[model samples]
Target: MIIVDPSSGTSPDRIESFSLESDHSIIVTSLEHHVWQELEQEIVCSLKRLQCPRLLDSTVLLLHKLITNIVRTMHRHAFQQAIEDDLNIDIVSKDNVFDELLQNELNTHGDRNIEQFCRKNHFQVTLTFPEKTDTLIRIEYPESCDSSAYLDSKLAKAIGFTLLKQTDTITPAYYCATVVRDIAQHHPHLEQAGHSELLLPDDESDKVLAVFCKLNYGIIVFSSAGDILSISPAILNNLKLEISPTSAHTLTGIIPGHFYNDVLWGLALQSQGGLFENYRIRIRLPHDDSLSILFNISGYRHHDMTIHTLWQIVSLDHKATHTLAEGSILNEARVHNITRNYVPQLVEQKAREIVRLGGNALLNEECRLAVLFCDIAGFTSYVENNEKEESVIHTLNMILGRITKAVRQHAGIIDKFMGDCVMALFREPHKAILAALEIHKHSYDFNNLRMRAGKDLLLLRIGIHWGKVVIGNIGSSDRLDWTTIGDVVNTAARLEKNCCPGAILISETLYEITAHMDHPEIRFSKPFYLKLKGKRNKQAVRYVQTTSQTLLHDIFTTHHAKG
Candidate 1:
């Protein structure tokens, strides 16, 4: 235990001695009110000299309550004896004699009796100032008290105290009071609940599960009658909702019109003892853009037979696949038991692994990688000329989705989506070229669908380049994106911009690797020198045309004639 001595001046030894003596200890003997009053006064004086003005009052009250609880737990038999001794006197027969005798005995020998009890029961209170960044107040129970027994007792009922349980091995038993800063940092809601009184959670398992869901997914818990019990902050922020005390929000109020019915159906299925997992739905956003969301529902039966439900919402935007792990589903019969028993162990293991492996060591690296860029040709003009923004966006997403699918199918990483373009990275040059060819073929299929729907045909332009690029996390500490950057990336973007619609372009470096491969369905244009933007010298490139190129051109010609 250590504390800075404000009074000791010019002598390090004196300061160290004062700090050592500053630790305060009190022995609990009986539940007599006067004993605690004197002890509280001593503690208050010591706190006053400690110079923590902001926390002085709260700490004093907290310590008093904690000590009182300790006394009540350890001195229950002594209290019962005192009360029984008082009850022995018959008040109706000799009230005056009883009062005088009891007062004399208590006044003369109460302190001696308390001292004897203190020696019998090994309960003592000690205040030690540990060297820590944050202020802390902790209570250590006697070795005889097991962790469960201590936690079940009144001493552990205080809110904002973390229980460090004892084990058969090394970990000792203690529960420490949460300092003000710790509370604000870890449990901000408790501060808003007010400091006058603190409330403990009814069930610790529920608290653990709530935290896990809040961190990993956007979750909403509903009551039996569909009232909103709790909702994650991410959901509120994503949906732009304002929940207040006076107003109420319903499912219909928060969810988009297109996806609301699906959500309702999911809830109904769960209520009927059915499992709903990965129920995919599309939600249209402003500007006619849409988001792919997957809903998973879990249900719980309360002691009163009321059925409650929890909805785990995961956004599938930019994800390569739309699916959830089978083991991730919460088991209806063992959800509580599993979460209570295993979640903590899982969290600890993950933390240790992260520490063992330097957190960012694997994510950031320099390697030889392939960069591919795909853009919709004339998308800006299409959006401006098309009055129905919905159709324009729908067409845009269709093309982008096709490109994303092709990239993922070829084992490429989708770095990011920029407006109408997607940037992806791959390890092998052949895979990048293959993915580009696949995307080019899919464009023709998309055009056929548009032709049937009486909508204008859209074209796609793709570019591929292979070179040494630094692929790692970029952005501020708070928000980061795993992306690639180098001359290779810029060159790919330029190639995409220069390529004609319905064609795939490759840089000389990338073409060298695939030029020898036998892709009978693909036709490579003669290698030519083209001046690319942001380059001092002209770049050697070739346009790779698939077998569907002629069909795409025929469709374009027919569409122009129809228009």
Candidate 2:
């Protein structure tokens, strides 16, 4: 097995160069550009255009793969140029924004607009190839203009599989070094990408602090006076520190050691927290003189309240020049299964996680509630006759937008949207009824607006019921939905199906709760014992129809008052 060692720029700057006794002639070259501006532009433009939250990962991966392929092509071009210096070797770079990689996704997936598809649902993405090759390529994409947070290994792997033109998998160290390089150069923009906290010392002891550091990675410790207390062979070799560790080696004895004390002691004395205690420094190479290695210094306190610093080292060159050879790789179905599972998992772990609140959802609570279900009248026919997908979506969104505003105005929360239907919940029965009334009142105007625009007028039906409900987030641990679920929820759906167009139907439980309200314009249809679908017994319910609004109040005023 090839082991990782921090290097001083002999190999490419992506992977830790490995040497085996049998094959020692491996040559490496670093491609000197963070090219592919076309892909970056597409990423920035299409970010807002995407609809589903899960597809965000795929979008990033697609762009990353594009850059990776270009880089691989550049690496091969560099090799050919350096060794062969051929009479004529043309790469013929294309300017098309959606080039070969994107075209392959279109052909292999479908003819739909990739951006629009991403807008509708979570699309599966697998940059990892089923076929294998020996060469591995590493790529790094900027997370943002000002953040140290970069995408993790899974993303790097996806880019590797898709763009390592002739590789089985991306070697980890190759890509991780890209992260290290980024952190070093952009020290001001720290990588706070997710909730992963930095290593902390539990006990207030410098020795105990070093205990945890050694468990994680190699570390070198030094006193506040800049004297070396302990050293790890890995870090010492990586930095090529000339000073012999005699427990009295002042940090200033070394070259860039002047900043070493400031970085280590200054932060440690200022704050007891992890945020300010971290620092990055680069050391010039003894051999090349022009090249350097980056080291990360972190500070901690001992039981005696003494400040101690830790040193972690990484190589500057991370790129790799893999020798192409045949190897084993996964199949297409395996890749599909892998991709299908991964995108959703990422959404659950990274996207849904509330970063500020430490992954805890804010809407977890129980309350008495009024559930409302509303659906479009003859929606199936509207969809079936709709020839243009964009038109159908536009019309549907227009209606939902109006309905959502009405509910929100009346202190109701839209639980979820189901195709041409929505389920909302309210804590007050009057507010729920008023929300339904708001929909009826505004729809007439909505239909009129559509008619003037030469569009067919659509109708809506609403059903409401009130009962005790756990009005918070509930679902699988990873995927949570902020909605309510109880027997009363089902009854509201049943009432909506029984409701007529422009009518607000409510269960008897809801009627009894709101019967005390002194609303002059509100009138209920004759209360009758009706056997709703799937119910064995008859139940008391009422249908609320539009009478008149003598109050002449706006939708906002009606919400705060009786309807």
Best-matching candidate per TM-score = 1
- TM-score per candidate, chains pooled: 0.39, 0.37
How much lDDT does candidate 2 score? 0.52
Error of 1 at 441 (Å): 1.3
Query: Candidate 2, after superposition: displacement of residue 151 in Å?
Result: 44
Local error of candidate 2 at 141, Å? 60
What local lDDT does model 1 show for residue 86?
59
The local lDDT score (0 to 100) that residue 553 gets in candidate 2 is 25
TM-score of 1: 0.39
Best by lDDT: 1
Model 2 misplaced stretches (Cα beyond 4 Å): 1-366, 452-454, 471-475, 549-563
Report the backbone clash tally of model 1.
Answer: 0
Query: Relative to the true structure, how large is the alpha-carbon lDDT of every model?
Result: 0.56, 0.52
**What lDDT score goes with residue 196 in model 2?**
58
